[model samples]
Target: MSEKSENLVEIRHLKEYFNVNVGFFRSKPLKAVDDVSFSIKKGETLGLVGESGCGKTTVGRTILNLYKPTSGEIIYDGKPIKTKNDIREFRKKATMVFQDPYSSLNPRMTVSDIIAEPLDIHKMSPSKEARRERILELMGYVGLNSEHASRYAHEFSGGQRQRIGIARALAIDPEFIVCDEPVSALDVSIQAQVINMFDELQEKLGLTYLFIAHDLLVVRHISDRIAVMYLGKMVELADAKEIYDHPQHPYSKSLLSAVPVPDPKTARSNKRIVLSGDIPSPLNAPSGCPFRTRCAHATKKCAESMPELKEISSGHFAACHIL
Candidate 1:
């Protein structure tokens, strides 16, 4: 694949599969992320949205090399990350903010130590004083005060804990971060504050992000572009506003229709496109498109062969037989 200087991270045909035990001695390959491809520009946020167990988190983890990919190419900053040493080097420039803030942090560790862990592992700081300064600086960047540094993770509120997680992710001064549902565990009111903080940090630090979430409203707010995933495949990808205003795929339209509008009149008039049946299991996915079983527009062609994601318009791509 050709390298683009403007792109910070490029994922091509990325697939992650897990072995599931079905019988006493038999197992099946569960495709968590299958043949996914996309690229994030320098200092841009790509929001990944899907229902639970849609492999959204797996994509983020795979990009950061947290989960070993089954087969694919991951390019970072014009270099291909293929070997162990490359992954080790890539870790310094990439980090992840996990889904659950409460479980992501160690309860025994103080906020200072938690944030300083990355620095300690990478030996980025010259001395103890420098590490302490870095930790405090990161905390301050995320809206935490110096006094809160001594407190343990359990002592802080849900929002505060998430801030600490963000601080830890930022401690390494990473260029790219895989935010795997960072604010999902927090209260509804706290969600906006944390999301806004992410925006501010991205602007202040020039960070690139792969934000994974189930909530369309939250994703639309923080993302420049959004990619909709179903089962283990990408259904549609486009600019956030373009996807919201004119979602082309059947599944994408269904997802956008469910986003609750604030205005009562608009909400009342909006038609929700309810998808039929549950998402097919990845282990036993349909032969053609992964979403065909639940899609209203599915036809005989949709069952005959899988649809390749094609550009219907400029910068808008969708995998659908009908379109």
Candidate 2:
């Protein structure tokens, strides 16, 4: 496909701010997603990685219109989403596999019903027979048996519940999926199973993904490209291998340095670049650059203004005064 045609989703200067209650008669804009932009190519997995509360999940939710964006544009398949009709149509084309599977599923509903909820909402299956058949087919895709379909979510393991969630996400036959830390809640072994299942499903269905997670190893394993976020802003984004080999931003360096290396020799040689302080509250963020508080390379320019995320190398983008 041509480069322009290759892009399935594009985000432009997306910002999602929430009004927080600080004290009596006090409020502030908590910049959850602050001027972030990127794109996901057709049938490719774009991993978004950051520490907790860095707005990774918020970005995904905002794009799907689960939480309306405070500002900026969300374009799907080259068309900008604006109207309620656009969102309704977008819902059928895109879906999410939430981070917490246990709470995401309803205790009142059976596995079959949970899987078929999207189908019913979209009026996908005309007849009851077709719905039942479709639900069974989806269950099979996620390695669940037909017998398990009638069971409640509480009866299954964490892995099984997540599978049910994934099956539901696929019910709409979506072209794009926002996977919000989909494997983080499972066991190490189960995480592998779920991650592999995602890979298999993407290949089989030609799906595009915005895979959000804090797990660097998982992101590295699945992503074609990776974007690093810090204090609600995108610090760096590049090809997965490129970022791993040579990250441009100081924050990216620190994050990658902490990823546990399996090799005894490599693990022993790797130096962890630990940051100096806890991430500052979004409600009281630094004036210039949010990462400057902990960055070793912070300079006067960094404190003066936030650097723009721009291309330093071919398809490699970073925001830092020192770089």
Give lDDT for model 1.
0.93
- CA lDDT, every model vs. true structure: 0.93, 0.95
| Top candidate when judged by lDDT against the true structure | 2
Candidate 1 local Cα displacement, residue 162, angstroms = 0.3
Question: Pairing residues by index, what is the TM-score of model 2?
Answer: 0.98
Q: What tens digits encode model 1's per-residue C-alpha lDDT throughout 29-77? A: 9999999999999999999999999999999998988889999999999
Give the clashing pairs for model 1.
none
Per-model TM-score on C-alpha atoms = 0.98, 0.98
| Model 2 agreement with the true structure over 1-323: per-residue lDDT tens digits | 47667789999999999999889998989999999999999999999999999999999999999999999999899899999999999999999999999999999999999999999998999999999999999999999999999999999999999999999999989999999999999999999999999999999999999999999999999999999998899999999999999998999999999999999899998899988889998888998999989988788888899999889999999998877
Score residue 73 of candidate 2 by CA lDDT.
95
Count of steric clashes across candidates, in order: 0, 0
